[model samples]
Structures are given as structure tokens and as C-alpha cells.
Target: MPASLSKGGAARLALLLFLSLIVLVFAVASATAIGDYNIALTTVFLSVTNELGLTGADIPPIEQSVVWNLRLSRALIAALAGAGLALCGAILQALLRNALAEPFVLGVSAGASTGAVCVIVLGIGAGSLSLSLGAFAGAFAAFGLVALLSNGATSGPNHTILAGVAASQLFNALTSYIVTTSGNAQQARDVMFWLLGSFGGVRWPDFQLLLVVVLFALAVCILMARSLDAFTFGDEDAASLGVPVARIRLVLFAVTALLTATIVSMVGAIGFVGLVVPHAARYVVGPMHLRLLPASALTGAIFMVVADIVSRIIATQQTVPIGVVTALVGVPFFAIILYRARPQA
Candidate 1:
């Protein structure tokens, strides 16, 4: 309602959203059929149906475990994490008025890496809560430091970027130092793999936590869509439109940080979903946040599920890291965007 859309445009938007959702569902189902075991699509469908109590299809225990526990959980995490990251990226770009802003642009990922490194390498918290707690702490710490150094959310994007860069460098250095000096070879390998990201070890519990967080974040983002529209014009313009510029900025930042931290804790700093998916959605839907957010979430979920499938298939004996796959795909897209965004000579 904020932005006027012609009937044709609205219909097109609806079609796009519909198509994106279809793609997302297909991606999830297909991804579940991928991996080393290669479960049949029929089995995947039946197993899901049986679990939901729609029908009692007799399935082998091992296949049921693989489908329900391993593949489904991994697929769900990939979907939710992708959605959350993309949502955060869209929010950050709007909040900062910067095209390049993303979920990790503010050092939250680096901080998370540092925290996870501490737990894994130093044995700092050595229990169920160790990794997640450390990651949340470090993420919030980095965000707080960035806010302080940038003189809070009112300091503009440049200052915030600089502060984030500084914090990122510091946390990244700390992670590196810990890995190089204190960690054993196994710990080092684990840390490196985690930093690069993976979904190999995810299970129902992890998926459940991520599902809740991502859904809650999405709801909050959708509620704030109108305010995000006001923000696109600039701080003064938004304030004139009755938007509380600073307060909204703070809320957006906190939500993004919390979402980023949760995902990073679950699956170690997977990159570029936040960056690439939002830009892609914006291109399709224009600058309207209301349309862009859902489109971005769906696009991101599809992208991540596909990327996860690629990661599994890229190597027979060993899985490729999700971060590596994303980076390989995202870097070229980013370059193209930058090139196109540049002024014509």
C-alpha cells in the first residue's frame, strides 16, 4: 500500500512470489534427495508424509533416519539460514542507506568466528552451550563496539562501515592467532571448516532453533517494511515522514545482529546469501521493501538449498564447504553488479 503498483505490476509481483515459493519447495525436496546416500524422491516424499501422519508408508529405518534426521534437518537449516541472512542484508542496506551493506558487513560474522573459535579451540565453555553462547556474546560485543566507535546509529554509513571494518579485522586476527598458536591439528581443521561453514552435522534440534529464529526475524522485518520504505529516501526525509530514524536504526541493527549471530552459531559464517539474494530480489521487485523482503527470503532459501546440493556433489569423498560454494558464486555476481552500478564512461 505504501508504493503504488499498477494492477499488472501487482499481478506480476504476485506471480514472481508464487514462482519463487515453488522454486524454494522444489529446492528443498531436491536437496533432500541429494548427498552421498541419494535417497529417492518417492522415499523422501513418503517419509515426510509418514512423519506428518498423513500416511504410514513403510520405510527402512536407515532411510527414514537419513531422510528425516539428516537430509531434512540440513535442508531446513539451509533454508532458514538463507532467509534470515537475506532479510538481515535487506534491512542493513535500508538502515544504512548503503547498497553494499550486508548481514556480515558490520563484523558480526567475524565476531562469531572469534567466539566459535574460542569455544572449539580453547575449550572455553566445553558443553552444550559453549559454541552458541560464545558466538552470541562475540557478535553482540562486535555490534556494541561498532555502535560505540561510530557514535551510535546516527553517525552515517561511512563511519559505521569503518567501525565494522576495524572490529572485523580485530576479531579475525584474534581467531587466527588462536588457531595458529593454541589449537591442535584436529581443532585447527574443525575451526577452519566451521569458519568456512557446513551443514553436515546439523540435526532436528539445530533446525528447530534456526526455524524459530528465522520466522521471528521475518515477522519483525515484515512489520517494519513501511518504515524501511521511508528510510530509502534518507534520514531527514524519513524523519519528516514520521519515522523515528535513530530508534528504528537501532532496532534494525539489533535484529540483524541477533539473526546473523544465531545463524553463524548454527552454521559458521556462511557468506553472500545476505549480499547477493537481496540485490537479486530488489532487481526483480524494485525498491519496495514489502515486496522485496519476501521475494528475497524465498530467493535466498532456494539459492542456499541449491548451493548445499552443489557442495555435496562437488566432491565424492568430501563435501565442499557451503561458504566456498557461495563465495565462488557470489564473487562474480558481485563484480557484475559493481560494474553495472558504475557510471558509464
Candidate 2:
């Protein structure tokens, strides 16, 4: 443990964790309550308890279905996705030593979007695998290409970022061509909604899958906390500290790409949670990965749930895209960070 994370700092971190947990609970409850059906908090509690077989509150089937099958599932997925993306961002920043690096910086999101668009618009891979499968395959493909182009993490972060940019542009162009040439209004609308992100049809299965992936990835990251700290001082410093720089960087890149692809496959490219949440967590907990990772995950979860709730409330007849809500918030937040980072006059 670092000296900066002294007893007092530990205590403060614990307190923040406690408060964030409380807020997460409240956020989930509030999200369940808000919606077209307008479930009461008591009803939401009762419904959840009933579903868990803890109580026999005779809630109506319609209400029970809405609360359990719809709102709760979506909220859980949003939280999981947000946590996963934020974790990816934190890891990427550490791995690449670039503050601007995020899960999608490797063009994984673009690749995933292209894969999903292929499935939705062209009906490719429609029989055996689903849209998510296609998206993951595409994301991995993009990441593999970027890794190959960048010489397998041996070159430098700058080369990796450039490769990612090129791949992203290529995939984005393919996605645009597919959408424009498809000429199906319905397909185009569906693809657009997905690109912008949504949690409308999310269910327990999707939530469970994301939960497993996030928990597994998070555990791996926590175990690598010390090595990540070493990476902060540069490859030479990290290597001197016995960190396998190349191997660790490669592994972390793959992990981040997989995490990002999984989430994008489910929820579309909901940006900024990855880019901004880690920065916000660093502001609160400093740059130590041991503390930063979990803090960022919690903060991201909270942000995503709040964003989803706001999206639902912003429109009565139709829900706003989750991506739009996030971008609307993230753009200004990103600007503020950049402004603060500018050299003092």
C-alpha cells in the first residue's frame, strides 16, 4: 500500500464507498419507481421481495412484471455495463499511459457497431448466433487488427492509438455504407437506436451475462493493481519493478476490448462512462488503481443508472436514447477536464 493511502485516507475511502453503495441502492429503487407504469416505492420493494420468495405481497401481475421483468432488469444492466466500461477505461489509461485512452480507443466500439449493423441491416449471421455474438466477433477482429498494426504492443501507445483511429474510420465508413444502402427505413431506425444505445428490451439474462463478465474482469484487474501502478511510471520503470510490461499490456488490452465489446453488443456505444468516470474517480481517490478501479466502477454505475432514469423522464411518449443522455452530459464534463488540465498561464 502507498503511504498516501494512510489510515485517514483509508477511512475516507471507506466512507465514500459506504455512501456510494447507499446511493446505488437508492438509485436502483428510484429507477424502478420511475417509468410509464409509475410504480410506487413500496410496491417496488414488495414486488422485489415477492419475486425473491421473501414475501407474499399480492401485487398485480402487470405491476409485478413491469417492476421485476422490465425496470429492474434494465437498471441492473445499465449498472453492470457502466461498471464494466469504467473499469475498462481505468485499465486502458494505465496500460497506455494516456489519460484520453478509453475502452473504445482501440476501435472496438466501431467494430462492434459495424458487426451489429451487419446483423440488423443485412441479416448476416442471423441463424446460429445473435446480434451480440456478431458484435463481439467484430470487436475482437478490430482489436486484433489494431494490435497487429501496432506490432503487438511493442511499438508505443501513440502507434496503437493511430492504428485504432484508422480502424475506427474504416469500420465507421462501412457502417455508414451499410445503413445508407440498406434502404429499409425500419432497419435504419433500429440500427440508429442501437448506435445511440438503449436498455428498453434488456432482461435478466442479459444482466446476468454482463454481471458474470464484469465480475470476472474486475477480479482480474484488482489482482493486477500493483503491476498497473508500476505501469504509471513508464515501461522501463514498470519492467524494472518486475512487471512483464509487454505481456501485461497485451493481456489488459485484450481484456478491455472484450469488456467493451460485450457491453457494446448489448447496449450500443454508450460513450463517456468509460472516458469520464475513471477521471472523476481519480479526482476523488487519486491515481492508485487499487482504489481507483472500484471507485470508478461505482461512480460509473451510479452515473449510468441516473442517465437511464433521466432518459426515461425526458420524454413521455418515447424514451430518449441512453447514448444521447450520456453524450449530452459527458461532452461538457470532458471539456471541463481538458480545460483544467491546460497549463496555467
Candidate no. 1 TM-score? 0.96
In model 1, which runs have C-alpha deviations exceeding 4 angstroms? 1-8
Which stretch of 10 consecutive residues in model 2 shows the poorest summed lDDT? 1-10
TM-score of predicted structure 2: 0.96
lDDT (Cα) of model 1: 0.88
Residue 27, candidate 2: Cα error in Å is 0.4
Give one digit per residue, the lDDT tens place, for model 1 in 159-221: 888999999999999999999999999999999899898888788888888888888888888
Root-mean-square deviation of every model: 1.5, 1.5
Clashes of 1: 0
Off by over 4 Å in 2: 1-5, 343-345
TM per candidate comes to 0.96, 0.96
lDDT of 2 by residue, 125-190 (tens): 789779989889889889988988899968777898999999999999999999999849999999
- Clash count for each candidate, listed in order shown: 0, 0
